[model samples]
Target: MSKFGFLKVAAAIPHVRIADCDYNARQITGLIRKGADRGARIILFPELSVTAYTCGDLIQQPTLLNAAEQALGYILSETSQLPVVGIVGMPITYGNALYNCAVVFAEGRIRGVVPKTYIPNYAEFYEARCFMSGEEIGFATIRMCGQETDFGRNILFNLDGVKFGVEICEDMWVPAAPSVNQAVDGAQVLFNLSASPEVIGKHNYLLSLVKSQSARTQSAYVYCSAGYGESSTDLVFAGNGIIVEGGQILQRSERFSLEEQLVVADIDTERLITSRRRTTTFAPHRPNERIIVEISLPKNPADTTLDRWIDPQPFVPGSPEEMEECGNEIVNIQTMGLAQRLEHTNCKKVVLGVSGGLDSTLALMIAVRTFDRLGLNRKGIIAVTMPGFGTSNRTYRNALALMRCLGVTSREISIRKACEQHFADIGLDPTTQSSAYENAQARERTQILMDLANLEGGLVLGTGDLSELALGWATYNGDQMSMYGLNASLPKTLIRVLMRWMAERCKDDAIRQILIDVVETPISPELLPTEEGKEFGQQTEKIIGPYELHDFFLYHFIHNGYSPAKILFVAQKAFNDRYDRGTILRWMRLFFQRFFSQQFKRSTMPDGPKVGIISLSPRGDWRMPSDANADTWMREIDRLIEEEK
Candidate 1:
């Protein structure tokens, strides 16, 4: 069996009645069993679930407190047979004061108790009137329901592989939440048992709160609130529940549901841990006042089936409006970054090779915008098109037309003669189409661009994108070397969108038509000889898998650090009816091999602004040894191949 890095967790909103301890306990116990059966290792209930949050002054009654304790004991006994670890909210009396608390229990035993740090006393809330803050008690040992439990604000439960901390309602609403301390104390997940009443527009605020806290703490946060059966005399309890991991909300419950609701999600604990490890800004361990309770989970296999949303295009938005907005923002970022670079360098002109392809076209457009932003003349942007053996008429015409229409200094330099001479000098035949033949053209074009920049007192702009860098598709020291690269951070999949967006915004009809044709043209190096006519026969996508699949693989592999099995599984679901499993796996294996081999190209890459999370810039987002072995990864891929067969 494959070891899963996910922990199946659930937030349960059980039906509650005010001060009805027995009924609430039954509801709680039943949910525990259901969650356990569904493979939830950790299940959390709403705040003050034993006696509903709306109990009001009845919380002061000794008889009601005693009944709550008895009902809790009944729940513990009933759940002893299950393997689920639970956090149940109640009010516990220690010394001469009562503190609202969440008790952690597993295998029929109370592991520890955590008190509410902040008690809300504002409108519609009077918690401060009836409960003492957990901060007041610090740490204590309290005997209750025939067992002595470690009680206080300083308590954490680390069981098997999941270490989590507990807080209550208003604790999350206050600044500097206990969850921050809990995360600093090595809590991978934070559970908030809440009884917050729903007001107008509070759900959106609460949802943002949970997401921000999870992002800030770099931990998974599960929140559950009191439900419909609670006393609605003053405020309505709609039972809002949420589960978030790494700033992304995985699941949220429907509000105002009368039935018992359980929101379950599989949180990737490995991914969270990896994020913390990668980020050096996270605080080290502090002196903890909480007791650490260690528990052993059952021997059942972990659930490998994920229940979270795995976006097919993690870098691109699915909505058309959002796509346009994202495209505009990305172009702005690229242009602004280039503009700043140019101003800092005090360069007189900008020179770049324009292939009339997506990447080069985007780079050319950015150069124009940068010079325009700096109030420089359009002639300062030198756009060069080097037509080689396989150059198609369509792309060559588009490149020349775009340059003329954009009012830049256009230059046409054919690399066929230079490449033939270089190939002959190297004792290679120019008639044979090979890597040498192709790379010769690329190197010759680069040399011409570099020389032109030097003569013009400008900088040579690189057009290789992130996707190409990931797959090592650029020729080393040929197209890979540049003074400054504007498209280094943009992926191939997104570059097409930016091209179309630029066309849409173009004022001149000729320039717009040229940009549209460039977007429609097939991506290729145009270094090999065409078949009979000037049509493009060396299409890049046919050689490398589709950009969509490669980009998807790159995002999940580098950004999310997902395993091959998980990536393959999600790709099957995301690209269902489009690409079969065999095709995805074949391309995935190729991706891993080339990615490992291509580190040399990215290791010495030029300076470029990082526009996204998955930049291959060695100085910024990624740094890997060029010689690192991929045997371990290949073994996993082999296993997947066998399974698919």
Candidate 2:
């Protein structure tokens, strides 16, 4: 494992020759050495790989079984010097019964053996005819290749401090998989040696199965299957190798390739361990008589780089199809939440403020949809564009255009006079761009919306997003207070994506163009005074760092419980081309500082729908104290900054 708790593992598919143990041994050994060279600590091979799974009835011959054992022995001796734990499938016999087993070996020693618990007798499977089920066999010791090792279905191999379990082809397809028990017994990784034949639509289903099992167990799952060179008399073996962690596919091998394949991935064991701990239902069950064999692997150099894809925009979907689906779902969620709130209150009117920004534009769109969904007139949904001291002509024009095209009741409410009068009453100069000056404008606009909601018997729709809430960008009791927050769980980065998607689906060219411009506009609160010939006086990212970076930090820190240092490590890799380590650390410090200081605002935040996995709903997902200290978090970041210097 690296300093970040990443365990590099590989799933290998070696070219095979049916019943030719010596040739298969050479192929497996070469792949093992290659995996070791690539820094893989654990390498897995397909089921019955020593002698190809298609050996059929020849599997019953004593000569073939002995040859398989000799092949395993040769592989062990050949790769004994490498710092990798190799698991290979072969037939093992004891007490006059043959069992399909996964033999674990490292440093020239057979650590342990785990047998297949479930035997398939269904279509295209006749494993029950040759091998006895090892489910009833509790725990025992067996001699194989001149070494005595624990042998049973209840055996786990411990390399260094990490424990992993193994299962065979049929064991994984059954309802009661041994991996579940192994996970409960504190196994962090699971391996499966499979030789599943490919059929129509089976590959997709198999991928889903592996993903679900890894998610269910909260463990890193490494699966390898027999590929080319397996006899294809009635079935074809499309070599399928997959490495999954916590329901996400990290890497997969190309299927039906004639050459031997090795697919490697770095599994975040720290994330898996943290996930299991957070999930209350993932508890230990009835104890089983399991044996854990401790194998010491040679120490390797620590890895300085990650070989996995780290998404810079975790909230935004990577693919276009997924973006379309997720965008529609988020819109539906926001629209439905507002619709339900409107129905519960029996109010057909909703009062919202539109600044031609991403958040407000999205909220306005949802309100229009809600009114349409309820068969109410669009005029009932009032969209107020309150021009303040910092309002820009570009945004002002776009706001009016969008409200007009959407056919909502557009109102222009100027807060300049109101804020100036309040400034005079408070005996303060409005010329100074202080916190009070900026916040007074926000409070006055909120007060106007509140009174209008009362006059029209409507609800004040809030536009504050998750990213703003995390940074405490909203003034307390100003824009933060709402009847119901539709975009509370949505982040700024995602709001832009959703608006773009909505623009593409829009039939009105005018409204679509306005939406597109709104997405391109820089994000800001428009609280300061605007100068002539300027788009806006203030930019949010300039002050709070990029929303993309904050969203990435938020997901890892809150959703994955990553430390500030670890978040920096991954963030550096994710945004390496755009940002350096120093810039990320600088902004990360600000994130932690604001996140801790702004708890009081979130503590009293209004009710909002939780749309995603990461939420700051104090009453639901997150419940941090209003006065939590950021000293420890800051110290870690400070140390990293010092290292950079």
Candidate 3:
């Protein structure tokens, strides 16, 4: 593994000539060289690659078997000088039984050989006719091609601190495959040498299996299947190469290609280790009486680029279909949570403060949906628009337009008079636009919402989102305090996506247009005085860095438990196109500072439904001390800045 915990691996599908050991061995050697050139520490090949999986009954002949062994010896000799491990499938004879096995070799020496556990005797497969199952064959020694090595079904090879195990084609299809035991025995990566023929819809099912298996084992799975040049008498082999880590496919080879294919990707073993450590239920089972073979390879260069996708908007879904499904589910969750709350409280009304911002807009929509679901009158869902000093005309108009279009009971309550009175009572100059002046408006708005809810027997719905809570941007005892916060678990980046999705599906054109305008409006608390003719006086992103970056940091830091340095490393890659290194560093420092300093606000945050994987609920998902220090995190960022200089 690299210093960053990344191990570069490759899945190679070489074009082969059936039963022609010489041609197949040359092809395998060439692919290994190519994979090594691309910085792959371990290169894997398909099952029976030495003589080709299509060599039907030729496996029973001693001449063919000896030729296959000779071919493997040739491959080992050719690629021995290269500092990379190569795993190829061939038929091995031991004690009057031929076993279809994966031979692992590195630095011109045989590391180990893992036999296929499950022999398939199904309709399309007849492997049981020639080879015996290696399930009962525990740790044993085997001699092949003038090299003695450990041979069994329970063998794990370790190269530079990365432990990987291998299984054959049919072994992975069974429920009790050897990989489970291998993983339980502390294997961080798994490899499958497969020759399964392709049929209609089989590729999709195979892809799903790869994804699910990697996810289930919480390890990197590299699978290589036989491809072009295999005998096509009954079934065709479309070289399928897939590399997955933690259920996500890092790379997949193009199927049905006639050329030799090699899919290379860097696996993050450290991330997998971290995940396993976090999960309590990933219990250790009956450990394999495993044999470990260690091989040391040269360390990867420090300047090596990562070969994985780093999502910029980790909170938002990746694809359009995923976005649609997730958006619908999120809205349903919000509405159902609110609906249940209202029903439990026996309240037919909800008082919400709408500022035409993303958070309030989303909360108002949820309230309307909840009221509709509960069969309550829309007028009872009071949406109060409190225009404060920072309230811009665009947002004010959009708020009114949305309320009018949605047919909610809209009330325009100006907080100017209330805030002025409060400032005078507190003996503060009204002209001084301090935090007190800003927080006073927020407090006054909350007071109106609270008083109105009490008079109407309703709940004060909060509009403060996860981002605001993370940054402590909301006012204490003001916007931060509500009877129920609808968007507490929802982040700002996701709010934009959900709003856009709702707008596209909205039936009413006017309501849809209003929602669109609200989504496009700049995010602000509207607590400061607005400049003349301006839509927003203070931009939230300008004050506290971009929500996209913050959400990314929050996801990795809290959900993935990544340190500040690793988070910054990935963040620079994720947002390299939009943000420079210095810009990302600047905001990342603020994120840690604000995230640690603002825990007091989050500690006392109002009750809200946990919608996503990352939540700051003191009662549920996240619980942190209010006085946790961030000096260590800050020092890391400071060191990074110093290194940059």
* Each model's Cα RMSD: 2.6, 1.2, 1.5
lDDT of 2 by residue, 143-200 (tens): 9999998888888777777889999987778788989899989899999999999999
TM-score of every model versus the real structure? 0.93, 0.98, 0.97
- Measured on C-alpha atoms, candidate 3 has an lDDT of 0.89
Model 2, position 150: C-alpha lDDT score = 88
What's the C-alpha lDDT at position 24 in model 2? 97
Question: lDDT per model, in order?
Answer: 0.88, 0.90, 0.89
> CA lDDT of 631 in candidate 2?
98
Residue-wise lDDT of candidate 1 within 1-645, one digit each (tens)?
A: 115477889999999888999999999999998887777888999999999888888998999999999998999899998878999999889888998999999888888999999988989888888998888666788898889888888788887867899999898999879989999888999999999888899989999999999999999999999998998777889998899999988999999999899998988887888888878888666567768889897744444456677677777766779788888788788888888888888996999998888898888888888888889998999999999888888888888888988899999998877777788899998777888888878888889999999999999999999999999999998999999988888888888877887788889888888888898898887877788844787899899888889999998888778889878877887887789999999999999999999999999999987886778999988999999999999999999899888
- Identify the superior model by lDDT, candidate 2 or candidate 3: 2
Best by TM-score: 2
Residue range with the least summed lDDT across 10 consecutive positions in model 2: 298-307
